[model samples]
Target: MRRTPADVWLALPQPFLASEALAAGRTYDQLRAACHRGDLTKLAPALYAVHREWADLTPAEAHRALCRAAVSSLDQVALSHLSAAVFLGLPHPAGRLGKVSLTALRSTRTSYPDDWRRVLQADMPESHLTSHDGMQVTEGSRTVVDCFRQLRLRHALAIADAAAGRGLTTPVALQAMRQFQAGWPGVLSAERGIPLVDGLRESWLESASVAVAHELGYPLPASQVWIHAPDGELVGRVDVLWFEWGVVGEADGMAKYLGAYDDDPSPTAAGQRVLLERNRERRLEGLGFAVARWGAADLRGGGDGLARHVQEARRRARPEQIRCLWRQDLKDPLQEWVWPPPTRA
Candidate 1:
């Protein structure tokens, strides 16, 4: 029987056991052959999902299916590391994925971890454990710390920033969570990177761009800044502002241009977005700001080139005809930026 698109879409939600399939009139040999031939995916020892439908899922959604399929087979294990981070909706690199991350509660024994094929293990206390629809998972802060300790500095900073940006966790709490994995090789990155995270960053690329800019030895720039005209008219909320240098930097990701945030993903919509952005940039220039915009490709090669580009833009900056808001706390890291500025600095 030929399956239609609707059939696959409907089957997506029904992750099932091999026993269930056998009971539903599917032969064991047919199931085994389908899995071996890539027609189906075995999410756990006995759990299965349609391979085509599984591939259609976003990384987080796919991991969720993987977890639900495996949850009953594995006991005393809470989702940890990247698995828990994505499950809790933390900032993750788009389209990036890994196997289900789990940590044993009482002792280290598991079906997947025992085989060492599709699961990674960490050790966490029961206190850090939480439940999601009766399935064990790590708390947000603990998951952030676990993910941060394992990911690269730029990648880790995004998770940290999202956690802080939404008030999911604080720096102090992350510091406390670090103790669980203390003295391990990867813990140092989490410690060094946590303090550098800013809640004001609005995207993974923005967070990554800041990390790259910092690595290039430039002082951290104020982010999520609102620029105003001389007559008190609103110009725009710019991404990066170095008030002293009059350099305004923008990280232009595909989501900004490709209508990822809106219902339309058409090229016409993208072109319209670009035109609107150009108009916005002209307004900022009217306010006497030099704008530096870069996308992921510009910074992919370790940002040496992006640094030079920004420095060149800095050189083009004109004398401030209209004052732009810098983080009053930029010079003082201890004082946090209270989301909306009380008054211009």
Candidate 2:
């Protein structure tokens, strides 16, 4: 059958069984035919999917599809934790097709060929569940709770920020979820992930800046602060800027500097990208902005290390800029002065 947008929208991501096909007014042959031709993707027996490729499935759409497929097995499954996270389109790891997470209330086991996760529970707390298209799921608050419990702090925070960005959850919701979690897993997870749950009102970099500040007890610098060169050309906007100290902090997430799904045909191309970043940082420094750079490693300790680097940058810049100027010569200050760090010598 020629699948229209509406048809595709109606079809779930998982494939259906012969019985399900028959129930839906489609014969077993028709369902099998669709599967054989790649028209429908079979997630498991009686679980069928008709997705628009990975790019086509929005987080909500993916979650909805997973719900339908799981529910067809007799409401025996509900998406949970990172799996629910993926369905919600939160940017955690395993962006690709990994194990699809499934949770059930009663002690009934299910089998599937595809990667599947099963969580069985007697009671999952009403506060923890939310209705999405009339199906039950771990609420956005609870999802954030589960995120830290189930994954590393950075990954959990990344998911939390993405959810916050999408308006799926709130910092207050995170706090409430933390309160409700009673077990050791819940307690520890909430501790690690709660601070990172602030609703930062800026880009991903700004969010990182907030996390770093909270983790290190350092004051956060102004985000998206504009810095200019001598000739009036915008040298660049700093990710986080210390106005008083003439220092600029930049979080260099590899996904930003290095685009995802890299297809490096030539080794020189990678080297050239590195050279370009170096040049960009050098130019920023020339604009009277002492730059402190960081990456994924800097985000370790849930942003403690990142904040320290920012602090150090501010300390170094203080001696040079007793009076901070919005307009400073676009020349290399580091070249003119030699305030060197003293070694053991």
Candidate 3:
């Protein structure tokens, strides 16, 4: 039986190129008709995927799929910046994947589809380039550095924290990259954030909370600290821990729990999870730690609001109420060696 274009696309591996389909004896008109019929989804110009498969992915995953599909069509370009971050499996702020970013070694007048963005940069050394699963992308250190140089401070810290948290790169490596970027725009912002990067930040919201805390002159907090009850029973792991302040901060993003527990898809499961969290908080409070909880609102409201909320919690933390619970040390060895360690003159 002769197959339809949609059938042809479904039969072939997903994210296939239009040229490949044409080579397989499928007419362009048929491919267009399949798209019109909503059987195939266009990932990029001339790049298509099975509609059902594409629909199953989250926005971030879909962005990654589009980037992977678009790479074959990109000429004289290597994925860099945010695109590299995504391709390298590094963390980045959540958003639409509006365009695929590429970096070229030299100036080029080559045109790409509207969805493709080319950055003509001559400073990308060969060492910074790497190939992952047949797709060329920037190395982790270079990718994080480029991201720091391009993104705003909050988002830059997010990328750096994610990179460190994932063990993809380190502050020392990023500092070395920064040395090469002297006099470059956003270099200072990048430098300021590199040392602050912590891989223990399990989520972007946690990273953002830390960034906001720093902006408000709040002493940096230890991440993922263990809370124990007076009887030595493990209470739970708290998000941000300030030992000296005897305060703990929680960066709550509903997506964290909801996304993980969506399999149940019932109010009962969600209520149970909420109750569990509340009980955990009560247990920590029972141990004499002043707990500060902020959700996506404080994070989105900027540093001032988050700082106020955190400060209020700190104020309420009385020395009499403070406990002497020992914090488990989970510091990264890389964090101890200072960036640009002092040199005797």
Provide backbone clash counts, one per model: 0, 10, 1
Stronger candidate by lDDT (1 vs 3): 3
- Between candidates 1 and 2, which one is better according to lDDT? 1
| Model 1, span 49-108: residue lDDT tens | 787777788877877766665555566677877777777777776674766677777656
**lDDT scores in order:** 0.73, 0.60, 0.73
* Candidate 1 Cα misplacement greater than 4 A, ranges: 1-27, 33-39, 42-47, 110-123, 263-269, 318-345
How big is the RMSD of model 1?
5.5
lDDT of 3: 0.73
| Cα displacement (Å) at residue 40, model 1 | 2.8
lDDT of 1 at 215: 76
lDDT of 2 by residue, 63-159 (tens): 5455555555555556777777766656655344345556675657654454343554524666667767666677787777777777765567777
Question: Against the true structure, what is each candidate's TM-score?
Answer: 0.80, 0.59, 0.81
Best by TM-score: 3
Supply the TM-score for candidate 2. Answer: 0.59
Model 1 lDDT on a 0 to 1 scale: 0.73
TM match of model 1 to true structure? 0.80
Q: After superposition, how far is residue 330 of candidate 1 from its true place, in Å?
A: 18
Off by over 4 Å in 2: 1-19, 29-41, 49-64, 105-117, 165-172, 184-186, 201-237, 241-247, 252-288, 293-345
